[model samples]
Target: MGMITWNCTEVEEFILLGLTRRPGMQIVLFVIFLISYVISLKGNVLIIFISRISPRLHTPMYFFLSNLSFLDIWYTSSIVPKMLINLLSFKKSISFHGCFTQLFIHLCLGGSECYLLLAMAYDRYVAICSPLHYTTIMHSSLCIKMASGCWIGGLINSLIHTLFALRLSFCGPNVINHFFCEVPSVLELSCTDASLNKTIIFFCAMLVVMGPFFLIIITYGYIINSILKINTSVGRKKAFSTCASHITVVTLFYGTIIFMYMRPGDIHVANQDKMATLFYSVVTPMLNPLIYTLRNKEVKGVLLEITRKRHVP
Candidate 1:
């Protein structure tokens, strides 16, 4: 065991070859990403604030939306700040510990969002299908429990991946092609046989990504069925409107994720992978609050009310 371990000189740090090396392109990318980061922060914070202050927005739907917005804040934060710093810096590097910590946090939040979306879908299902018992079924206590479970599940999933990553030995050639420390990119740098890591990643992707996705699909099927059953066209339209935002979010998020992780190994391209990661990691979080607020009338009315009150004073 000692002799085997001695064969590898473990690297203490990694050189991140961020999004671009061209000086002009770096500046352009920095400005774009910086603006995106600011927007993401402001939008998600506003969602959380409005959800808390407005009594009309105190339902299970908004409750989950607030949780989702909070998750987006940290999710984008975990990678974007470090990425932005590296964009402008000459020697773009991250310590071994820092890289892994980012990986753990990124995965934790991503996994958590999957279940949170599922919870939101379930909320819609309850509201549309079983309208009379919606309040009783999705009570405050149950909502809290579901939200807590999503976090706990993500924590465990991230722990498993992080622990498996820790077992690998990195010898030399510590340059990571991506801006952030994702599991796939890090695994490529490992000197040891990483077949186990690949296997585990695929296995967990099925559980964490595909599992919730399929469940969401099934839940929506029931929701649609119930909505169609309503005799009035106006009622059906109203029911569909409530789910539009969530469906859009799910499509954007899950499409990129599946394209990134679920495909065959032969088709993988580094640049394509990077772009997909950017969309889901950076772009999706920024768009979430906009999607929710623009599609949601109640949230818009509350925002208008707050704006008018502030101006009156």
Candidate 2:
């Protein structure tokens, strides 16, 4: 495909054509997203707080859960506040630096979560499949190293993408189609060829998204096999319960992500893209804390005990 040569000028700012153009709808969206953002923040914060204060919850599993909650808090924060502002604002413009900064942070946190989930899956795998050596294998030093590696890996991945995106020239029509600056949406406006960007995106998606995802699947396969070997029904149920929440969360998160990134570039639809991004970016974070806590007896018990103490006083 030949590059479309537009008048070459530096794009200093970008107009984010947000989720909706209708005035009435923007207000409604603002209200809805504000509530969602607040809930996501509070819920994730509560999980972090509960994990820290309760000694019973201090294990490899809860340790990873707390990391996940922390990541979710920043993941939602990186996008939602700007989205809420855009929903309420008439202009809906973001500076060029700001847009790419959003892109970097979003990708960093997102990539981090992918690896964190993989780490969590590995934790579950060790706990279930190697019950005898679980504590020794997932020791504190090892867990910390794994968590740090996830963050550092994500940072490196985001930095590469952001640097390449910055190099792309946006000479004209500096309008982003989506509510927030994302790889696909921003690439659409590039005056220069974005084939390389797309290629990098595909390559990185394999490394940061699909790679961990497939490993998780393999890890869970072993976990299921181990669960099946347990003699008693009650033992099997207990084993399955430990995994249920993580499976649900993985499905919900990775489903949207695969749809968004893994599909062919030619199959672009603005509305579908927006909705998919909204589900993963905004809605999933809000649901994660609920998924973890509601399904977890230990977390629930701790919450109940904390509530009872306040009520007694």
Q: Which stretches of candidate 1 lie over 4 Å from their true place?
A: 1-9
Error of 2 at 294 (Å): 0.8
Worst 10 residues of 1 by lDDT: 1-10
Candidate 2 per-residue C-alpha lDDT over 1-313 given as tens digits, one digit per residue, 9 for 90 to 100: 4753333448888999988899999999999999999999999999999999999988989899999999999999999998888888878999988998999999999999899999999999999999999989999999999999999989999998888877778887999999999989999999888888898998999999999999999999999999999999999999999999999999999999988999777787998899999999999999999999899999999999999999995
Clashes of each: 0, 0
RMSD of 2: 2.9
Model 2 collision count: 0
Residue pairs clashing in model 2 are none
